[model samples]
Target: MSKPLGKILSEGKTKKVRETENSDVALLEFKDSITVLDGEKMDVLRGKAVINAHISAYFLEILEKKGVPTHYIEFVEPNMMKVKNLEMLPVEIVCRNIAAGHLVKNYPIKEGTLLNPPVVEFYLKDDARHDPMLNEDHFLILGLASRGEVKKIKEITLKTNRILSDALKAKGLTLVDFKIEVGRGTDGKIYVGDEINGDSMRIWEVGTDKILDKDVYRKGGTMEQVLNTYIQLYQKLLGKMPPIRGTKNE
Candidate 1:
């Protein structure tokens, strides 16, 4: 018989999740690094990892309180989170509220157009193929997820959009769009997985198209500017500033 696997479940572009031997909980370690354009662009912005870790934990906790299932357990350290170990699905779910980014480039819609009844998209979570778009049929054919699972994912994702959109509105920000990952838990239930931070979403200041998310960094903004913007957004959302690490407060 084959031996049981050891620790270190998986690693991504900016984070790694590890499971202790004989434990069902995993520790997610966020790195002080950023990647854009499928990681063709990269840099390390001090304090970013900690800020994102806190922000993601805050959002996940809020969602959980709202009855949304998630893998998030608790924030363990400045750049680490303790979470439920999950068998992650190979798909990325995206919910868009405003026409921006690839929506404008791929469609005839103008930038900033309100997508009434927000758009939900599914993409195969393969970095090598740049996460190609997939439809329901595609998913079924590829065995990525069952029809029931897809339905459940969409339901949870839309509910999440409503909750986050309203929450951000109260903070004078617009939830332009966001991406989330999902996974199956030991209980055989799917839950929202991965980090939900600035990097996963496009946030803009209310009433204006002032970018306040990773888009700023992707568009050639300075590291200081990116960090400051993230701090400002986090403060606005949580009503307090996150502690900085390895960087001076701006």
Candidate 2:
């Protein structure tokens, strides 16, 4: 099940990629495996890949309808997505609506503090360096992105945060913070790329800090609890249970 040379692309903790039947498209095969703390903590959660693929597709479609450009093409399988092949930008755009994670650990911010206007941060996408935080000047110094490009990335990220936060609020969940990657397509336009699932976001039950996202896996939560929370979220947003991989129907 391996793709030919030049057809196979990059691999990450939870995803693999190969060329699709369409030359301009690629298939992202999500895996059941999960990684946390910079891949130091890892495990296999049955059915997770399927759930994430479906959830990512759901959000991408909604964002597309809202005039946000993304690389998403379609869900080709329960655990695979067909997307436009992109020259990914080497940065991770993060928008935080609440003080948590590194925000609290690195800064003096108190946990649960509401960021009235969500804070946007950028990190150079270098795993070996643990993805060091970057500023606009850093982007210029490293030749990673132009100031204009950085500005646009921030704008799009903030808009996405609003859209996702509102969507989750309607489902009785809160979007604590999320990270997104962007890329340039063959069309010569920058679009949001990569998947947006529980792994990329921190979600909590409305009005309470009941973790419902990957933070569970990071914090030693059980796989059963993690999968159940993901299922509940999908059911709330999509009005149906996601088909689990390895099942007859899936």
Candidate 3:
């Protein structure tokens, strides 16, 4: 049986975390609201949440199967899932592969240039501050995470990148770059938390560099175009396209 959803614990642009009867468990509900420019630009894409729930579940499950610890517990049909109620950090870990997005904008590195060894960066999850990048010393000085925790987090993150990169490559997609959130669980262990869907990652088609992820929306693609890309990517990667519960596909 499933636990009853409780009051809102927190909400972000595309998801909401709800409390549950079990203190260590929480309900994560996906929101159809999609935003770009750090929530400045937004729109409601019906059924977006439902499909991303599936996308995130699919990827996180892969990580779990490969022995990666995660807060994802179980996926609930439609729009919600159960997850470990962790003491989530206000940080985001970004791993870059081919240069694009901010990498190109912030640095002289040309877009699409391959990053040797793949740069992994830490960032403070502050929207108002534009989620400023943090160095290892910054992490320790600001008490964002302990030294050991930071080391472990980076190890896990890099390993996750390898696991996911290979997985997507097998499907003819390139893992351009992605960000993930980590939290300390009640078990005193760090875990990969938050959703790992197209929203959190840049996935491009290999040879043609066709957009197969949220860049479709981020770069000004229309709702129908973006949704179509998400749907097609799901079916392409997972090989099945069930009718999404909240969209016309249903």
CA-lDDT, candidates in order? 0.89, 0.87, 0.89
Cα error, candidate 2, residue 168 (Å): 0.9
Candidate 1 Cα errors over 4 Å, as ranges:
1-7, 246-250
Q: What's the residue-level lDDT of 223 in candidate 1?
A: 89
How does residue 116 of candidate 1 score in lDDT? Answer: 94
Q: Candidate 1 lDDT, tens digit per residue, 1-250?
A: 7443336677888998877554788889898889998889999988888889989998999899999999998897668888898899999999999999999999999999999999999999878899999999998999888889999999999999999998888888899999999999999999999999899999999878689899999889998899898888778877777788543443
lDDT by residue (104-155, candidate 2, tens digit) is 9999999999998899999988778999999999999998888888888888
Worst 10-residue lDDT window, candidate 3 = 241-250
> After superposing candidate 2, which stretches have Cα over 4 Å from the reference?
1-7, 245-250
Q: Give each model a TM-score.
A: 0.93, 0.93, 0.95
Model 1, residue 17: C-alpha shift (Å): 0.7
Q: Please give, for residues 1-250, the per-residue lDDT of candidate 3 as tens digits.
A: 8655689989888999998889889999999998988789999988788888988888899999999999989998878889999898899999999999998999999899999899999989888998999988898898878889999999999999999999999999999999999999988899999989888899988889998888999889989999898887888787877467544457
Give the TM-score comparing model 1 with the true structure, all chains together.
Answer: 0.93
Model 3 residue 32 CA deviation in Å: 0.3
lDDT of 3: 0.89
- Show the colliding residue pairs in model 2: none
The true-versus-predicted C-alpha distance at residue 86 of model 1, in Å, is 0.7
